[model samples]
Target: MQVFVTGTAGFIGYHLARRLLEDGHVVTGFDGVTDYYDVSLKRSRLAALQQYPQFSAIEGRLEDAGLLSETLERAQAEIVVHLAAQAGVRYSIEQPQSYISANLVGTANLLEAVRAHKPRHLLMASTSSVYGGNTKLPFSERDAADAPISLYAATKKSNEVMAHSYAHLFDIPTTMLRFFTVYGPWGRPDMALFKFVSAILAGQPIEIFGEGKMRRDFTFVDDLIEAMIRIMPLRPELGQPLQGDSLSAVAPYRVVNLAGGHPELLMDFVAAIETALGHKAAYTIKPMQAGDPRETAADTALLRELVGDLPRTPIKAGVASFVAWYRQYYRV
Candidate 1:
């Protein structure tokens, strides 16, 4: 299989691209190596992927439409997974224009490239944050996701509709994956787990947002990759919806939640980190930040129907694995 994956230097993209390469598939990765967090970390991930002979990488921003189109044309990818975007909920509040440039414009360019190349299957990343301001537990893909609290979520929601339009007009089969809180080895530094572990190890106080009252459906990175691998082949067909499907009536487009379907409290997650690090963390309880949700839960009926019996890694084990990796990587 020939796959073109954007955000290859990112956490989820790195895992997905590595898995594909290990399976002996030809993977052409694209990344801008932005300094959103740490450029060194992104460079390390790209270096790891470069070790694989089957893996090739292109260093360019998604905003560069000509480069993206030309690369897609040369790769001639059978499958295209769009994952690159300016990610960070609170950061989006600080730099809203970055979101517009990366999430909105970047995705629009990728869709155009895909429209021209016409891949067999197109999988784009969405977010559970799109189910904003809705007090519904276990969010379903069939539910309305029109109200997004943060600019980041709003951009992702825009991507979904944008892809739908292209799918309808260009006859592209597209699947939009709404991911919950994804964390594991080689995770992003801005994420909760990494911050908690780092603070605890350095004997610094960690800040617990929402006064430790928020809940999240945490999905391990490996589980997310597994679900994605299974979903890559199952393209949506019009009028062929499955039970509890989010398949579109007009286009070969569908939205599915990729998560463990289990919600855990913020305090419990912190406890797991403490257990993994063998050090109790000194933390201060703080009010929830703007545009942040009190809780997020995903209804995975559609996911299970599509990919049966996925591996759900326990929080303690997952945190432990990340701690181990963090210690080794940072030499802490």
Candidate 2:
């Protein structure tokens, strides 16, 4: 299958595109390569994909309305996977406009392109941040995601609404995967694991937010990619009730929680990283910031039912793999 994938320069996108190419699928990657992190990392990811004959990449923002349509037509994409977005919760507090432009406006444009082209399967990403302040121990697909604590989460929730509208009106088969705290090799710099690893390696004190009380369902990139590909041909049908909730009854779209379904404490995760790097982190405990949740755990039953199993990469192994990659990438 020929696939059109956005954010091929990103961490998950880079891994996903490589896996797809390895499986003998032709992929057209789209990315803006914003200086959200290191542009060098993005370029390196693209360079790796360039080694594969089946991979093609486009450098542009997703909000570029005309560009997306033209690329979809030119690539003759039968499957569309949209992963590009302005990510970061704390960063959203300062750069709210970035979230609006990429998450909201950009997503709307992608939906329009899908409506025009009518891909067989349209899988876009959502986030566990949408769960908001709800004290739900393990968030399920049926739970209410109406209360988003951060603008980033709100925009992602808005994407779900926008995608559902397109799916319902245009009869587009769409699936939205609510990703948990995803991390691994080629990970984003803004993410906790990356920051912690960088600080520890430099002998700098790591900020332990909320007095190190936060826990997250950190899903490995490869496991998440596996779940995503397995779900490609399992797009939900219209008129089917959404699992756990009936909020999306009008659309042929359903939200699936993609995670390891296990929440690990922040300190525990950091300990694993410290072990991997053979160094302990100097901790500076700080209060939690605005729009941040205390904890997150995924109820991936729906995803399991759809894909027969969910990703189960243990945190220790995942951390070790990331540490090895970080050492090699930076020559630490």
Q: What's the count of clashing pairs in each model shown?
A: 0, 2
What's the true lDDT of residue 240 in model 1?
Answer: 100
Residue lDDT tens for model 1, 114-180? 9999999999999999999888788999889988999999999999999999999999999999999
Question: All candidates' TM-scores?
Answer: 0.99, 0.97
lDDT by residue for model 2 (1-332), tens: 99999999998899999999999999999999999899999999999999999899989998899998899888888899999999999899899999999999999989888888888989999999999988977998788888899999999999988888888889988889899999999999988899999998888999988788999898998899999989888767856553453336677787899999989999999999989989988989999989999999999778777778655889999999999999999998
* Top TM-score model: 1
Best model per lDDT: 1
lDDT of 1: 0.95
What local lDDT does model 1 show for residue 173?
A: 100
Model 1, residue 125: displacement in angstroms?
0.4
What's the lDDT for candidate 2? 0.90
Worst 10 residues of 2 by lDDT: 238-247
